[model samples]
Target chain A: MRATIIHKPGDIRIEDVPEPKILRPTDAIIRTAATCVCGSDLWDYRGINPVDEPHPMGHEYVGVVEEVGGEVTSVKPGQFVVGSFATSDNTCPNCRNGYQSSCVHREFMSTCQAEYIRVPTADGTLVATPDQPADDLIPSLLTLSDVMGTGWYAAVAAEVQPGSTVVVVGDGAVGLSGVIAAKELGAERVIAMSRHASRQKLATEFGATDIVTERGDEGIARVKELTGGIGADSVLECVGTQESMLQALRSTRPGGNVGFVGVPHGVAIDGQELFFSHVGLRGGPAPVRRFLPDLIDRVLDGRIDPGKVFDLTLPLDEVAEGYRAMDERRAIKALLRP
Target chain B: MRATIIHKPGDIRIEDVPEPKILRPTDAIIRTAATCVCGSDLWDYRGINPVDEPHPMGHEYVGVVEEVGGEVTSVKPGQFVVGSFATSDNTCPNCRNGYQSSCVHREFMSTCQAEYIRVPTADGTLVATPDQPADDLIPSLLTLSDVMGTGWYAAVAAEVQPGSTVVVVGDGAVGLSGVIAAKELGAERVIAMSRHASRQKLATEFGATDIVTERGDEGIARVKELTGGIGADSVLECVGTQESMLQALRSTRPGGNVGFVGVPHGVAIDGQELFFSHVGLRGGPAPVRRFLPDLIDRVLDGRIDPGKVFDLTLPLDEVAEGYRAMDERRAIKALLRP
Candidate 1:
């Protein structure tokens, strides 16, 4: 089976690797139907996150369950399924509290770019569609495995209400998806912060009522200008840099919330600054498993179409080009089919 | 009139200061009936928060309205009233959103240690009691101006819900007051992290179901053990140090919240650590004005006796001793009668 491997920074290869098998009683093996590149993957590819040795890549996927260990009763072989980047046992206190990404027996799914992958804690991590989804629906369904669900969590974490004014602080696929999530959650006004014309168009299609191309202080000022001089009711931080984080925090009104989904890198929030801001902050790896069921329904019902985020598609053999295109800012996201 | 002044760190004095007069049409003059030394005051007293020059001290007080400016109609002269240390117009966007402390027209009361003090935004900052209370209720009522209200904000910001398991990481008056708040908010188990015997006793009286004496890692571990190894639902961070902040964050379960109220002196939060912890963080100068009315009612109803935190009392003329007693930790808090 072919798998995506990163030998070092700026080095990605499609190498033939042994197919994954059910390694635990709670695991299930799935034949990959679709997988994609993520912004976080660039952390390693760009040498920002050191790569000590070559390793399997990818954590998002939608596939057909090829086999399941005895203990996995909720999902069975031959079922078309979607699973989160982080696997969970679901019954743990954290999982029960809607933080499945923090489940006590959690295992983050890697090597999903391979032809076949094993999903641990299958019962809790994988949600099967009602039936085999149409080929056109696969891209949207595949997103439920990570990005779309993550976007939904961002909205929920920010406590976006029916009358909320939301600001999305990223232009990547996740940010565009967040626009959809905010609108679905009944946000009356969704502002997408993007200078890229292509991403801006997609964000508008996904329900962004406005766009602020400014960055830093000017960006904060622009948001405040649009929000009656205070700021938005909620801000979804999809980019994890210090600048993006500050943008999200400062663009929210006093008593508002910043749901930061971007994994922070080198960001140190000043305690005194945050205290005086009076803005609530909650961020982490999105508990995608917790939102899979609801998001799947929304996708199936055609209430949302997040697949538009995938502008470039290629065969699994072209995984390297996919990474390059995304890293060089030529593509919002690249979808690879095995 | 006599007022408490801090000439420098460790140098507190009772000085003859001119009586306060309404400086704003929204101001009202109050004859101080009771005031107290707060834990935050010690920051200035200990040189942690620099006392640049001789300045008035005290922000907590219960008093009788001496006079009202032309625009101050909600409070009348001679009426007993309670006003938060952070005054608010209550009509601003932030105030309307229940973050009165961040109101557009906000002021911090700093002269309340004097015999007579002026309160700005009187209509919104001062809440009049239905009737004058007995002298015995003075201490508790005085706390509503700051400590008690701050504690309530901690609980509220921490999202202390019915049946929650709460951990309070401070034993000062505000933290002791937090124990009461957690109980009143329907927490099933309230853990007070305190090593002081006297404070532990007061915490127990205020409804702490358990006490953890450990600090740092041991404290986090003990709290985890008490909370079924997952951590508490809500952690109130009342002592604003880096250690206390980390303790509060580590002791809360994923999806739980940490509401920090102590004015942070030198604290910086690592974004990565906090992100992976999955704990929501919201802190600031307590929006005391938001919780003033309810806290006043709780004190007046005798349902909560936060006044018990005042283990020592002094006349306004001996205000230096009041500061010294609290600074030495010889008293939980000091109530000053003018």
Candidate 2:
């Protein structure tokens, strides 16, 4: 089978890889129906996060089960399923507590941008669609694997409610998805931090009531201005940087909640500042598998169109191009069809 | 009036000080009935947190209103009152959000260990007791100014509820208070991490179901072992050191909450580790004023005895001994009568 591998920074190639086989009794082998290049992937592609060696790429995918180990029961051959980038045994204490990403038996499912991928803990990690999704719905369903669930987690973590004033930091796919999540969760107002024309349009279309083109202190100032100088009740942080993290923290009112989904890089928070701020901080990997069922229902019910984030789609063999397009800001996200 | 002043580390002197008088329309002069040395106060006494010059000591107090400015309304002369260490207007956005400790118009009320002390924002900062009580209730009421309220804030911030297994990292007055607060809030099992036999005794008396004397990694191991390897549901961080903070974070299960009320010192948390931990962190200065009403009711009703933390009491002139007793760890806490 062919898969995407990064030899080093800015160097991605499609090469032949061993066909996936169920190695464990709880494993399932699936044929990739849809996959995508994630915003986080750019960390390695842009040389920010070290790509140690030639490693397989992609963690997001929606697929049909091609085969399953004898012990697998919940999912079977020919079933279309959506699974998160991280696999987990849902019965663990952490998983039961709704933090599947931190599951005791958790495993990162990489090399998913391939013809076939083996997923461990299949019964616990995969959520099957009610019916075979149409081709048009695959891209949207693919998002359920990561970005959509991640964005939803951010909103939920931030305690977004029916009348919450929300501020979403970042205008990428996840940030835009958070706007949708905030609206679905019934936020009264959502301000998206972005200066990009296209993402700003998508943010508004997805439920952002306002868009601020400022960064850093200016961005915080704008959010405070919109919130009557009190700051937002909930702020979603989607970019993992010191500036974005501080912006999210400062953009919230004392006793407010900051749901930070960004994978922090070089982010050092001052304990004194956080102490005085009184804002609650909570976020990490989205337990997407825990939320997959509800999110899939919403998608199937036509309440949200998260697939709109995929502005470009290419053949699996051209996965490198997908990365390139997103890296150069030519597309919000790139979908790969196998 | 006589007050306790810290001329340098280990040099606490009883000195004549000017009588406090109402300084603003919102101010009130209180005749100090009880004031206590706090764990934070020891920071300066130990010279870790510098005492630059001769400065009056003490921040926790419970007293009777001696006089009020023309505009003071909520509290008045001859009223027994319990107030937070910090004064707030109770009308700012932060105050309205239940974070009065960080109110925009905030003022730290120091020099409280004296015959008379001035309280700013009297109407919002002080809560009167139901009735004038005997000296027996004075100590407990005094804790509402800081320690007890701080412990309660830790529990509330950590989202402690019925059946929660709580871990308290510090065994100081605040940590001891947290045990009481956790029990009052209905935690099923309260764990106190303490090495001191006396402190451990108080912890169990205050509702700690278990005590683990280990620190750092070993302490985290004990907590996980007690919780079926899942970690505690909620952890209260009352010690602001880096080790305690990290221990509190590592001792909780993913998705669990860590409510920290310690004044942070040398606590630099790695963002990546915290992000991966998936534990929620919240807390700062306890919004004591917000919880004063309920805490006062509980103390008056004999439901809790937070004042037991004060193991020694001295007349106003012997205030220096109170500080020295606490500094020497000869007393868990020391109360001063004026």
Best by DockQ: 1
Q: List the residue pairs that clash in candidate 2.
A: none
Tens digit of lDDT per residue, candidate 1, span B39-70?
A: 99999999998777889998998899999999
lDDT of 2 by residue, A229-298 (tens): 8899999999989999999999999899999999999988887788878889998999999899999999
Per-residue lDDT of candidate 2, residues B1-338 (tens digit): 89889999988888987898777889999998888889999898899998888999888998999999999999879999999998899999889888999888898988898889999999999999868977898899999999999999999999999999999999999999999999999999999999999999999999999999998889899999999998999999998988889899999989999999999998877778889989899978999999999999999899999999988988888877887888788999988887
TM-score, one value per model? 0.99, 0.98
lDDT of 1 by residue, A301-336 (tens): 999999999999999999999999999999999999
The DockQ figures for the candidates are 0.93, 0.79
CA error at residue B84 for candidate 1, angstroms: 0.4
Residue A289 of candidate 1: its Cα lDDT?
A: 92
Q: What's the i-RMS of each model?
A: 0.6, 1.0
Enumerate the chain B TM-scores of all models.
0.99, 0.99
| Alpha carbon deviation, residue B232, candidate 1 (Å) | 0.8
* RMSD of each predicted structure: 0.8, 1.2
Best by lDDT: 1
